[model samples]
Target: MTIIATLIVLGVLIFVHELGHFMAARSVGIRVDRFSIGLGPRVWGFRRGDTEYVLSAIPLGGYVKMGGMDDQVMERIEGGAVAEEEDGAAGEGKVQPGRGSADASRTEAVPSAAGRRRDSDFDSKPVWARAWVISAGVIMNMIFAFFAYTAVAAGWGSAQADTTRLGQVVVSFLPEGTEELEGVPEGAHFTRIGDRAVEHWGEVREAILDAPAGPLTFQWDNPRGEITVPMPADAEERRRVVMGLRYWVEPELIFVEPGAPAHRAGVRAGDVVVAVAGERVHLWSQVQDLIRASPGREMEVVVARNGEELSFSVTPSSVDGITPDGEPQTIGQIGVQAQNPPITYTRVAPLEAVQVGWSETVFVTGFILNFLGDLVTGQVSTRNLGSIVTIGEASGQAAAEGLPVFLSFMALFSINLAILNLLPIPILDGGHLVFLGIEAIRGRPVSAEQRMRWSQVGFFILLGIMALALGNDFLRLFGL
Candidate 1:
C-alpha cells in the first residue's frame, strides 16, 4: 500500500512539472516534440497536433522534448537567430517561435517537414522566451504546493500544541549528577511560567526555555504557591534543565485503528485514557511506559468518556517499532493515537489560508537551502538524506493517517521539488537558466561543445548523489 501511494504521489508531481513546460512552450510558440510523464521506453502515447504525450515505463522522473533541441542543428546556427524565410531569400524578421530552427541550411539533416521546421524551432526563439520555457516547471511546482497547502489549511485546520494548563511536573535527571531535583515536587502542576500566561504546555515550555538564565518565575495551581528558581545560563545546562521538568498532558485518544486491540476492546476516539493495569496514568508517556513493559498481558484499562469512566480488558499486541533515536525496538501497540487536551483549531478564511500558504511555501524553500548548506558544512550527516524509498514510506504513512495529512505531505514534496529543480546544478532547470542568462548578457548562447561538457559533469554529480541517497535508504530499511 505504501509503495502504491508513493508512486501515485511521485507520478502526480512529475506530471504537474512536465505540464508546466508543455503549456509554457506552446503559449510561447515553441514546438514540443514529446511530453513524457516518466523515463525510459514509452509504455503508451498518443499524438496530438505537433506533440506526442507519453507514459513511459520507468516512473522515476520525466522530461519534455522540444523541437530543434538536438545538438547538431544548434551548433550549425550562428548568432542564435534565423532571418531567412521559407522563400529562400535572406529577409530581416524575428525568428518564428513555433519551430526550433526554421532555416533550411541549419536543419537540412533533420527529417522533419520543411514547413514544420521553419520558424517553429526552439533555438530560433528569443533568449527570454527560452529561459521562461526552462523555468516553467519549477514555477508550476511552487504554485501547486501553494494551492494545495492553502486548501488543506482551510479544510482541516492546522494542528497546534495545546498550552493552556500544565499536565504534570517532575524532577530533572541529567548529566549523571544534579541537586536541583530536591526542592521540586514529584507532580507539580503549573499554571504560568514567568510573566507569560500559558494555557498549553508548548507555550509554557517555550517561555521557560527562552527566559534569561538568572532566576525563572513559576506559578503552581495544585500547591497554590509561586516559586522562583535559578535557571541555567549555559546552552548545555539549559538543555538539561528543560529535560528535567516534565509537563502534564491528558492521554486522550484521537484515533483507533480497526481490528486493533483498542478497537477490539471497545475503545473509541475521544476516550481519555485514565488508567492501565490498575495503575493511574496522568501523562500519556506513563501510559506508554506501562503498556510497553507488559506487552501481551491482559490488562484492565479505564477510559473517561463523556461523564462516565469505562473499563475494559485489553491484551496488547507486540510490534516492531523504531525508537526516537532510530533504533529497532519491540513495543506494545493498541493502534491508537493520543493528544494533549484543548486541541484547538480555527477554520481560516480563504484569503487568510492563501497568505498562510505563501508563508509556508517560503519557509519550506528556505529550509531546503539551509539543509543543503548544513550538508556542505558537515553539520548534517548524509544518513539524514532520503531517496524514493523514504518518500514512499512517508507518503504512504501519511495517506493511511488521513486525507489532510496526505495532502500536506504532497504540498511539502511539491515545495521540495521546486527548490531542488531551481538549484544551480547542471542537468537541471537552474543550469539551463544559467546558460540563458549568459546568452542574454553576451548576445549569444554558449558553444555546443562547452554546454555538452558541463552537462556531462552535472550528470555524473547527480548520479553520485542518487547513489549515496539510495545507500542511506537501504541502511534505514534494514535497521542498520
Candidate 2:
C-alpha cells in the first residue's frame, strides 16, 4: 500500500513537471514529437496529431521532445536574427546579390523552401521565447506546489505558538522532569516561572529546568478560564509540566490502517485525541509513552469531537517495536489517527494560502539547494542521500503512523520533486535551460560534442545521487 501510494504521488509530481514543458512548447509554436510520463519501454501511448503521448512501464521520470530543436536552438534563434545577409547586386527593378550574385542566387533558390522551414523552426524563435519554453516546466512545478500548499492551508488552520501577548502574564511551555511542576502540557504558556515573568516557551522551560527547590507559579489561560497553578515543592517531581495547551494545530489525516487497534477503538476521521488515559497527550511522544506503559491495558481516551469531549475505553494492542531511543520494546498500539489541527483560519486569510504555499515552496527549494551545497562543502555526508527505496520506506512509515503524517509527507515530497527538477543538469529541464542561456550569451549553439559530453557528466552525477539515496534507504530500513 505504501509503495503504491508513494508511486502515485511521485507520478503526479512528474506529470505536472512534464505537462509544464509540453504546454510551454505548444504555446511557443514548437512541435513536441513526444511527451512521455515515466521512462523505458512504452506501456501505452497514442499519437495525437503530430505528438505521441505515452505512459511507460517504469514510473520514475518523464520528458518532452521538441521538433527541429536540439535543446540549444534558443541561442541559434536569437543570434540568427541579428545576422547580416550578403548585399544583393544592383538590377533593373530587382534586388540583386553582391559580387557573386549569380552563384549565390542559384544556391539560395535551390534550398529556398527548406530555409524557410528551418527559419520557422523552434530554434528560430527569439531567445526570450525559447528560454520561457524551456523554463515553463519548473515554473509550472512551482505553481502546482503553491496551489497544493494553499489548499492544505485553507482546508486546515495553521499552528501558532502561544506567543501572542494577551496580558502581562505570557503563557509558556514548562519542560518535563522539572522539580517545580507536576504534569504541565509540553507547550503550555506561562506568566511566571517561580517569580520570573516568562514570555517565551523556551524561557519558561529553561527557568523550570534550572529551578532550585521551590513552588513554581504559572499563570495561564485554559479554554474554561484563566488561573494560576502552583508547582509542587519538589523541582524533580514536576519535571514534565506543560502549561499552555494548543489543540488541532496540524491539518487533516491522510491515511488509516484497516483493522488496526484504532479501527477497533471507535476512533474515526477528524477526531482529535485531546487526552489519553486522562493525561494530556498533545504530542505523539506523550501518547506513545502512555501506550508503552499500559500495553494490553484499558485506558480512558478523551477525544475532541466537534468541540466536545467524548470519552471511550481504548485498549492498547501489544506490538513489537523499537523506541526512538533505540530500545527494542513490546508496546501497546491502537490503529487510530489523531487529527492535525488546522492552522487558525482567522490568523491567515484564504488568499494567504497561496502565499503560504509559495513560502513553503521557496523553503523546500532552499533546503535542497543547501543540502547540495553541504554535499559540496562536506558539511553533510553524501552517503546520507536517499533513493526510491528510501522514499518507499518513508512512505511506509508514514502510513503506519497515521493520516496526518502521511499528508505532511506528501507535502514534503511534492516540494522536493519540484526543487530537484530545477537543477541545472543536462537531460533535466534546468540543464536544457542552462545550455540555452550559454548559447544565447555566446551567440552560437554549443557544439553537439560539447553538449553530449556535459550531458553524460550530468547523467552520471544524477545516477550517483540515486545510488547514494538508495543506500541510505536500505540502511534506514534495516537499522544499519
Instruction: Give all candidates' CA lDDT scores.
Output: 0.69, 0.57
Q: Scored by Cα lDDT, where does model 2 land?
A: 0.57
lDDT per residue (tens digit) for residues 78-186 in model 1: 1122223687542222233332221111111132344344466677778778777778888899999988888887886654455444443334333233344345554
| Candidate 2 ranges with C-alpha deviation above 4 Å | 69-120, 159-218, 221-348, 396-408
- Candidate 1, superposed: residue stretches over 4 Å from native: 71-117, 162-344
Number of clashing pairs per prediction, in order: 20, 43
Give the candidate number with the greatest TM-score: 1
Candidate 2 per-residue C-alpha lDDT over 46-157 given as tens digits, one digit per residue, 9 for 90 to 100? 8778676777666877766555433222212111111123553332212112211110000011112233544424666676777777677677767776676666667664
Q: In candidate 2, residue 192 scores what lDDT?
A: 64
lDDT of 2 at 464: 82
C-alpha TM-scores of all predictions = 0.63, 0.56
